[model samples]
Target: MAKPRRGVQFQHRGSNHHNGRRPSISESDSVSEPGSPTGAAMNGKLETSKEEDESPPQSEYEKKKQNFITRAIWTLVMMAAFFTAMFSGHLYIIAIITGIQVMSFKEVIAIANVPSRAKNLRFTRSLNWYFLGTTMYFLYGESVIYYFKHIVLVDKVLLPFATHHRFISFMLYVIGFVFFVGSLQKGHYRFQFTQFAWTHMALYLIVVQAHFVMNNIFEGMIWFFLPASLVITNDIFAYICGIAFGRTQLIKLSPKKTVEGFVGAWVCTIFFGFAMTNVLMRYKYFICPVNDLGANIFTGLECTPNPVFIPQAYHIPSIVTDIPLPGSLHIPSIVHVAPMQFHILVFATFASLIAPFGGFFASGLKRTFKVKDFGESIPGHGGITDRMDCQFIMGFFAFMYYQSFIAVYKANVGDVIQTAIQGLDHEEMVEVVKGLSKHLVNQGVVQETVLECWTGVVGNRR
Candidate 1:
């Protein structure tokens, strides 16, 4: 610029200057040197890019296969746990059901609890759990009183509670209601009331239905096992059929469901239920009611078999024989089957046709909440409530069905013992014993000498 140098050209290589030419070998080496910070950062980025290029993404089929394998493993584990609890004893089964109820309640409550709604109310969470506890106490107490009336009524300490169980339950509920009302804040009425309603819905759906399930178990393990098995079998077959030949949609509530699956499952469930009943009827442990509360599967129990389990023979009807045969020959048939088999057919029919509505109800609930599952408690199975939806309806139906149609009313030793001791005072009890002894003597069931000795002993005690 000073003199417009003709043959000589001037260049600057400052930190901010650019020559507009490719760098020399020495300059390039300096920029890529391992000791330089810029070189180290570039090297890191290059290695990251290389890794990304080397690793391939998983295909959709592979992902689905992996998920299925995971689900299968977890299902096998759950079944193992379930059968283990079943073989343990009735008490263990009750405990498992109770635990499931609590977990289900927790999941449902969590869904209902919106953070925006729960921000200010202090007692909302506490009140929910309190309601759960009170409801469980009431329902469980009713079951214990009814099933173990003899033992509970005889104990002086527990007598008052047993006698006024319903009143106690009501009073407990009233106390909780008062507490909830008192704790309501000035601006939080709407939120608190919504939570209140939510809590009660959970109680009805999870707890009340679970009470019926407990009753089914005490009535007989068969009542609980058969219905539950039928529902599970139906679910399995429905899924299998749906995948194999499903084309036409069954319902909008569950798009994955197909008409083919629904019909196929019903047919398979009926046959499975009939076959399962035949096998279970052979075991007295499954068919017998829990007479001794203290007895377990290991100690074993003894009871007269329900008449339904006993096989009986019947002749084929004449109407069937009236059918014209090709060769003018008639074949007489005698069928030998248990009465309970026919009863099982009824139960299986209901389980297949009606119980699945419970699943539809759950699906609607999930869609309402914008959730794919109730919770992740069971890996691939969702929450306990999710798995037990149809089971709850099935259990309630089984309990009602047994009480109305199948339950026997024979008086057992516990009934007699309760009537004798609980209905009489001390002196009346002694008199009743003396009268029984005298009656036995007269009937030649005991000797007069032995009766006199027993009477003398009773007199001395008095």
Candidate 2:
């Protein structure tokens, strides 16, 4: 039951590489080191396993199923205290985000296919990483709540995304999962999980930090989809394009991916911008208002201010209104509205572009580690990291962009408001007394006093 020291890599590169496909030192091309029984057996297994490991079969079914299950589990975990946040319902969303952190941490363990170990040192290390991730995730949510209370800022940093919440929630739990796997007390399994969990977490965290900064551009739960949909879409389309018309391979690391596929994915992504934008818009307006953005209260039409109603120089009840004296306040301030659709496009487009890089990064990792697909635990998809790879990467990206482009975008849309008084004619200044008398006859939302003020300063001046 012992594994060979020279474990075969999933993908076979040519002769000089350690990928296990090369001919051995024996006189015969097919044979191994001379008289080395162990080496010969290793050679035979390497030959057979190479033929068997063709990407583990990237399955669309598995992908969609995982997505559904992940979303469902997240929804359930947050239901407990979502309503408990009371008026702070956005806290519920943060709770859900926390759940994502936990699940994602679990996903890393699943991806690396870290075989369970019984050694105490290994078990403890794995548990530590898990706890660290969770602590970070938990702190992230707290940090969000802290800043949500303030007026939006200049430098964006989401402490929740940068915290150890992921470790605390799931990394710590990984040890318990393997300890209960079986009664195999003879050997160790904890160390493998530790290495696996730590490796996966290390890679996924690049994404975690990215999300913490760009949260403004990514809005609502749609922030989740920014990376999700884009990366997944890129994967599917790129594969299809590569299979259909690829003529050139982009790199030796990911030989199957082609230049044709890259172009096709890019072309398709532009369209995704439109579809994804609309999707986020709907989600923001209805499904998930993570920022309390769309929640506007209507004061009713009963006492709505008339657009044309002007105030007089000495209006009624002016003393009680506590109106700022002289140059302190600007009256009749105007509100300028920004187009929501534009913001959506910016978010979706940027997500579509940057999210796919996570997959590329994974491809690079597979090449560097000299492994294929990270692991074979997930069936047809290699491992959890393989499946959730883009989410991890894009999560960081989406969070950062959402904060920058969208939040900063909001800032760029002017806020200072100026209200102006109007005059009636060229002769108005000479008629303040007459204007006051003229104001006495005005009616409706426009008071007689306002009319008197307006006559001196309305139509005549620009």
Candidate 3:
């Protein structure tokens, strides 16, 4: 063993353990001058600082392994809860989404609340929550009116609220805005404004994007599940491929992301989407639009399958047909595939290529805050926001894409009822109802006696 350096002394492990006795001044190499109370206090602070600077007892790898185990457990738990909600009914899925939005918004808003609390700004968190509630009210109200207008339009209690929803939402936001401005302190104006902007950002990112996701669920569970599943599949394959073959870095924001992993995951996701779509299409519960929130996997739902879900044949392009090939090989002139498969390719591509940017955005945000995670809500998995960063963007894209490309637009019973109720006077409405009843009578759908009864009732009411 080498000799000890000058001015450095090593003590035996048991030397300081005797009788719980405090070490002498010289033994501790005291910086305090001869019992000066101030010096003692300074020395205590120094010791505290040193203790804090010491490494944690757990090894780095041990900590990482423990975190991994916790993360795995939570992931399984979340999956189980998600599948359970999915099978429960549309309402349960909507509830889960609503809860996720609230929790994610809380996690995001909490990050900025530190300064507000330091300044004793009483309404910072209040304003954030107020904005969130207002946004949810507006969004949920819009969705309810759009999807469930048949239910709401007939109900006297909900009709006025449904019709004036946008105005109500706007007024609610204005109230919050005015309150925020009034509560701004002299020195905290900048911080208050920043918080206001931050709150809006969170609302848009977490609440607004999530609103589209909820709408996707209403359109059909597949619209929600397929896109979500694609993102998750890509994420998993990306990790697997990265560990297996990752070499070149893909992005500066997420250092671990690699080009090999990205492309490999994209390929895997496309295949996964195709297979999952085929599986999901077989079930009316997943494929049909949500006409009844109470309907579940067991209860099922009924709708004519969308045209995209029907298999169609496409002729091979002449350019491809003309390509030289081996004499033994034959390329079919026509191939059968559901148009939805073509759409799935696009969805998978977006999930694999674009959605990861959302995660990168979250990573950059954490770096800006100098935080390793958003919060400890999920143990090793970090906050809900962290896990859902990509899902928000993915769901938003799915909604827009479905609307533009896949959704069939046509009038339904709700539209006819709404038009009759809103556009016609009482006499005109009676006349319209009588005309419909007469048409039904001629079609043999309603008996002639029923039409007579309806005619008599309408004329008397008029």
Candidate 4:
């Protein structure tokens, strides 16, 4: 290579340099990139950037850690609420539920693909109706209790209720439902808040009263936890099964929900219902009894009877009496007796079956809304309603079951004579029956032949 061009740089190789060993870098520097000092600095920069840009992608472990931490926090907050509801009970729950309802309603109204112009009006009406519904609920509950304590044991309104109260309550519920469904309606969806408001008021009034009656009767947390447990458990088990091995689509509407999930969920529901039925019914131990209501609305057996024979005295033995100072105490029996076994099973089975219907109904509603998730409020899950939508449906169903099935009390002399005395007496019931028989006879509807059905149905239902 003619001894190569020697300077600060050199091409050193085997003696057969012409065979091409080229240049080599050393402490003195022989590379062609730049000056030794400058090159070192530039290499440092390049290496640093390479390190920065090409650092290993976050490990799956790290991503999972972040996700877990996030979900844990969320779960903790929600679990706290549930625990509080379990502990603090009805009043607190009512507050929590009301707030949740408001939020759910707002979300529904805002998200529905309705015209912009109608949004304000619909939203206003929905809000108005929400307050109205809540007000009606409070009034209905108070009125029912008040009347129940004073009048004949009937539905929430009062004794001798004409079709007027029934119709009004029904109309309220219908109106509330309308406000929602009307808002959801497409094409002919005019967002008629007036009609919606009226219907909801009617329907919800009846339903709320019914809800109170059911909870009051059943000496359990069935009204609260029954629906929540069934629906939530169904959803949870279904998802778990679906994720593990999903095959056939459960529904054309939500293709992601599989038949495997449905079966798993349904089975889970039965087991859950059976197990929770007892637990939830027993949970009444933690709740404050509102009145002399029985373990369940229908049974009319006071679960927490006003602490009869309270141990107000401390007994002394003969030895203590002899001592004249020290005394040994004898404790009296203390118990919080529940209703009959049949009553518990009756409430449990009824709530159990009704709960599933509520879940199915929710699924149908979700399908109607064409949504997989209601909102992103809960990461790794969905909205509160998305999580609890089925519970609401189930609650309504249980409430209706309670009202339709358990609300009325046809007295037997020994069942709850005391409670009956507070409400309807035999004389009043006989009078109502008499009035109905006469009215029907005058109308020529029964010809006095079928007056029994008229009084039974009319006197009871109305």
Name the best candidate (by lDDT): 3
What is the lDDT for 146 in model 1?
A: 78
Candidate 3 lDDT, tens digit per residue, 352-421? 9999999999999999888888888887888989899999999999999999999999999888888888
lDDT of 1: 0.86
Q: Write the per-residue lDDT of candidate 4 for residues 248-327, one digit (tens) a residue.
A: 98666556778887777676667666566445444334332444332232332334422211223344555645543335
Superposed by TM-score, candidate 1 places the C-alpha of residue 317 at a distance from the truth, in angstroms, of 1.2
Once fitted onto the true fold, the runs of candidate 3 whose alpha carbons sit more than 4 angstroms away are 1-56, 115-119, 317-329
**Candidate 4 regions with alpha-carbon error over 4 angstroms:** 1-69, 113-115, 118-219, 279-289, 292-372, 376-380, 403-462
Candidate 1: give the clashing pairs. Answer: none
Index of the highest-TM-score prediction: 3
Clashes of each: 0, 57, 0, 28
What TM-score would candidate 3 get against the native? 0.87
Off by over 4 Å in 1: 1-49, 53-58, 293-299, 322-331, 413-430, 437-462
Query: Candidates' lDDT values, in order?
Result: 0.86, 0.51, 0.90, 0.54
Q: Residue-wise lDDT of candidate 2 within 304-400, one digit each (tens)?
A: 2211122223334545455675876644333332244445455445544565566677778766556776554444445555666666655665565
TM-score against native, each model:
0.84, 0.43, 0.87, 0.49
Of 2 and 4, the candidate ranking higher by lDDT: 4
Ranking by TM-score: 3, 1, 4, 2
The per-residue C-alpha lDDT of model 4 at residue 380 equals 57
